[model samples]
Target: MNVSLTSEPLRPVVQTRPVPPALIEALSQRFGKQLSLAQVVREQHGRDESSFSVPPPDAVVFAESAQDVSDAVKLAAQYKVPVIPFGAGSSVEGHLLAVQGGISIDVGRMNQVLAIHAEDLTVTVQPGVTRKALNEAVKSTGLFFPIDPGADASIGGMCATRASGTNAVRYGTMRENVLALDVVTASGELIHTGTRAKKSSAGYDLTRLMVGSEGTLGILTEITLKLYPLPEAVMAATCSFASLAEAVNATIQIIQMGVPIARCELLDAVTVRMVNTHSKLSLPESALLLMEFHGSPAGVQEQVETVQAIAAEFGGDTFEWAHTPEERTRLWTARHNAYFAGVQSRPGCKVISTDACVPISRLADALLDSVLETQASGIPYFMVGHVGDGNFHMGYLIDPNSPEERATAEQLNHQLVRRALALGGTCTGEHGVGLHKKGFLLEETGVGAVAMMRAIKTALDPDNILNPGKIFEL
Candidate 1:
């Protein structure tokens, strides 16, 4: 099980503060077997899917309950030591890096579905619950939670990153779906933000403030999420375009027409080839749009007809429909495996992924220009997008050992992000500004907004101990 992680030159220099002997003694004695100074366990908790590499945390604490998390934070706070919250370790933004070196509070064992208010269309769960687990737990209730974010990320991590994925085009992202959170603040005080009631004129909107804070503000102990009724009918189909521009245009028209498409993803020919090789299926090797519609039988048919017509106008060919749940699952599973496919496409290469979201109207301009630049660079890459909402990721596969390759990828990423910002879009759409994208945050939000963010960080986490060296630096 020893696999090498791809790393860039940006592997942060580990200038760690001393974990005082007294503090270590207190933690080891307080948690006993639950606490580990084991290097292997710390290594497992250290890195994430990001290509950026760094040293592991000094220690790891396996937290099983809300009280365990609160107590661990209290202990870490007493020593003024940095504490990083670890969930599924699925985030790709270096969200798990122990940049300043401390202890990692792992909550994966706290997996529990606390409550199911099916009638009220809400569910409460511990922070470690995964999206797939949540959907499975709620399946019998005729409801589903739709924010996917590709990986089977923990609900807490998903909320912290404000994640969205294939289904966000219809159901929205975590920011809209998350109702309430029971959070442990920087001072180790367990507080509740928001309520289960659908909408509220509540003070401060603290729930949302914590949602995308990237673990900078607090640790999420429990989360209450909004759920949606299962669509009466669901239909999925794939259509190939002569070129990416056509695919982009078709998506723009679909969104502009106000079609309630559940999922609309774009994959360039290069990506289709990788997916085909990985999934063991013969998908059309051209720019393609994978689309899904949800509604009544008649409504689904109408949408299908409309999108099909629009595709034909753009030289779409070989439109294929998935007639069974198994077929639809296969298609989406392949789609979700895109990152893995990209990595495997280039042996020993790591992905330096970019998250750029632009206005729907400007998607073609943003995406096509970036495509042209990447194609010119001759870097191995894959392009897939949740184009329904103008969000897409271009994964640059680069040789980790080649600093030049990494630099070229970063240059392309910078150009892509600047284009997105110019189009009135964001540097990061779903992936939070972890250590990787904090510089872009300043460029995107400007001096005043980032300063306000810093003020909030200072006010809430004056000790600067909660997941330090993430989002924005002090």
Candidate 2:
């Protein structure tokens, strides 16, 4: 397929309006000098990881408290301006993009560990607190938040995306971690959803409703999450495979055998090569499985034995164990660097990554076929995945400056998404359906589900003044 340069820039529908002097005055009265109008710029507000080019908001509101959030939302509602909740800015699907161009509600200033109930196994935190920051603060509490998206994203943003990572196989995703939330509705009402109880038969699960809403419904102020005791012992190991099929099969067997593996990531040969080139680490030019196990000493030893047996059945190479703390950290660090490594493979190429997940039984067949098709198409791509959860990412390196390559990359991405949905998998496993996956969402969830989602959005945001032109647009 030949590509043509799009004459128009990829931007949101633009609507021009004068900044409300009243809103600026109100912000000044409340936040003193903390809130600045100059922070809003075309590049600063609407920027995101997606290729969607957009202008920044008219103003940037720095909210340091729930009340501050309420005030900002109230002013936005009063002026009928769009309100975008910004956290961490790590979202790949254009979650942070201010499509309607109003106020960018930057929440990073509100980061704080509000309270910790080690006994209840729950912690209440301000929305701006990042996973790494929260964990660092709570390290001495003997309990920790388990969901790790590897991006050091804000707890609120992770919840907003319903994100999961390698550890998701055991700890589950944000869908299971979030217990409650403090949200400022579009009308600027402060509402508390859910409870601190272990379980509840509430009328509607509003807390869960807001989990992956992607800042379209309301602004997340505080999040209460379930926590777990730190594991007694953790071990990480990497095993090589001659083929991707063998590596996937080994992962499936281990999962089926009921061994509580902590994390299992799969990296195809192409991805391994990228990691080697970018990270300056020596990696064998073969498919690799980075696995970790968490449990008591005796339990971990037993798991190692079981996993070893399963690996042998699939022609897996000898498992390289990292028992020491530093060794385990180093092992995961290399895996986390896979994305950067992938982007670095091409000197001036940018990446367009797709996330898909299928049931464990079909994972190997789907991934093998999809990857083979991708490579046969002559697209330079890297494959990385949290294979334990049946989810994987394919990163296509493309020179956006080259119209031909961009067209090929987009076509390949669409094909991958189509194939994933056809295989009874989600178009996106962890990444939320931001602007990037809207088409896939329609295909995967069907028009009926899409209509229902639209209905919910309409009910919550009638004015469409919150991250407009994202997820669904008429």
Cα lDDT tens digits for candidate 2, 143-240: 88878886788998998899998789999999998989999998899899999998899799999889998888888999999999999988888899
Query: For candidate 1, lDDT tens digit of each residue in 236-292?
Result: 999999899999999999999999999999999999999999998799999999999
Model 1 spans with C-alpha error above 4 angstroms: 1-13
Candidate 2, residue 91: how far the Cα is off, in Å: 0.7
- Give the distance in Å from residue 162's predicted Cα in candidate 2 to where it truly belongs: 0.5
Which candidate leads in lDDT? 1
Q: What is the C-alpha RMSD of each candidate to the true structure, in Å?
A: 4.5, 3.4
Local distance difference test scores for all models:
0.91, 0.82
- Model 2 misses residue 75 by how many Å? 0.6
Q: Could you tell me the TM-score of candidate 2?
A: 0.94
Q: Residue 381 deviation, candidate 2, in Å?
A: 1.7
